[model samples]
Target: MKELIEVLVERKQKNASPLPYHGWVGPCTQVSLLYDGFRLGDASNYDSVKSFAQLMWPDGHPRFCKSMHTMATQIEELNKLIWLMIIDSYGLGEKWESVMINYKMLVQFMKYMAPPPGVYERGLFAHTDKPVSTIICDDQVLGLEVEVKDGQWIKLSLSPSSFCFVVGDPLRAWSNGRLKAVNHRIMMSGDNGRYSIAAFVIPIEGTIIKAPKELIDEQHPQLYKDFDFMEFFLFAFSDPAKHIDSGEQLHAFASLSPPISN
Candidate 1:
């Protein structure tokens, strides 16, 4: 918490683009107190798409033991390392393991607005191509959109210190369609636009992650099949531009991709 807060303060001082955020696994899910978020998913085709920054990873279950909470709260790296294990390592996490993750919700939001998965999967981007979503915000700000084509891009607004997650297509591949990576983009907002930072936890290389015994008790045996995190990360991060708007994809890539600025 100390290190995370320090970084946030520094970004504010710099008036950094989109501002910066520090992410880790904690007792409660992080959310914004002010800004609203969006999700977009439209893969059927349409060269590109976008949305707000978000990410997700299962914490398994919240800690009831005070001692465990104390340890996690004190050690920031533990929070980061655990997440790395999941994404980069492909989830070596067993019971009591917390995962660090990040992603932009814009893609999921766009997917929500666009036709369903089946619609786009059928040769869509080739026909009636679209530049981006029609967007409007409470206040226009810089750093809202990461980059632009033609004239502009789609940007999103979110409050400081708050974070969310998006499901990625790579996950869908790894999850065998159980989870889907979102396709989204920015709409070029002016205010509430900011930079973000996340420290995703990961395990060592060559560890093939699978569902733990706890999440899948006798009644529920292995809902999701197992796979290698390293391979999944490669598939997910290979073309970030393909899914930059998705917090889900970003969260999935946390274990694989390096920090954007530092």
Candidate 2:
């Protein structure tokens, strides 16, 4: 994360503009500059597939906060934890993700009444940060605009960077019969202001990633297997929605279902 901040800092020092908000449905092939600790897309498993965050705008990555980026030598603390993630990812074979969503959105919103930034892609999904926490907002909905998959759409009266985490379904599947992926998202605030930063952490592969053994009883044994990161990445990228369902299609690594022989 420190490295990410540094990259941002360097750019911001030159009076760079904040990176545009890349909506959830981003170009699957595009890459961004604001990189948290986790690798982006999983195209392959044997070798860690290098993927980057989708570019927010043409010149910048995301909302760049000059004040935050200019803070004390904060890079040291960030480097340490990243080391662990690197170790687990490379040495331990633990499939995982870790990220920090800055609060630039809410900050800028308070200044102007223009259209707000779109939700981050995969930003508000089905995964929760460990250590258990919640994000509350003061951006009350003064007026209703539209309806989405599960909730209402309204402008939030908040700052620019009110970042949060949403536990995704993919992690749940990877956890075997252990961890439960949580469904989540962000709502537009209208009356008040919100300020927050969300950091998401996940594990690496080669290890049989699964839910806590306690979650599974005798009635429900382990449902997932120790999968290759590349194998799983391929399945996920091709069809994120389909990868979550249970059946032969869900676990078809190397064409193992009907046509391909194991």
**Which candidate gets the maximum lDDT versus the true structure?**
2
Where does model 2 exceed 4 Å of error? 1-171, 174-179, 189-196, 205-217, 239-262
> Which lDDT tens digits does candidate 2 get at residues 1-262?
3333334433323322222221122112222211121211211121111112223224433333232232211322343344345335433425233322111111111111212354222212222222112222223322212224465444334444332233333344433423344333333323332222322222343433334443344565556554543354445445553455322333443222222111
Q: How far in Å is the alpha carbon of 153 misplaced in model 1?
A: 15
Q: What is the RMSD, in Å, between candidate 1 and the native fold over all Cα?
A: 18.0
Q: After superposition, how far is residue 202 of candidate 2 from its true place, in Å?
A: 4.3
TM-score of each: 0.30, 0.33
What are the lDDT scores of the predictions, listed in order? 0.30, 0.30
Superposed Cα RMSD, model 2: 12.5
Residues 145-221 of candidate 1: C-alpha lDDT, one tens digit per residue: 33234534344455643343333333333333334333433232222232232222232456454444333444433
The numbered model that scores best in TM-score is 2
Regions of model 1 farther than 4 Å from truth: 1-157, 165-185, 190-194, 217-219, 237-262
The TM-score of candidate 2 is 0.33
How big is the positional error of residue 89 in model 1, measured in Å on the Cα after superposition? 22
Question: How many backbone clashes does every candidate have?
Answer: 63, 46
lDDT at 122, model 2:
24
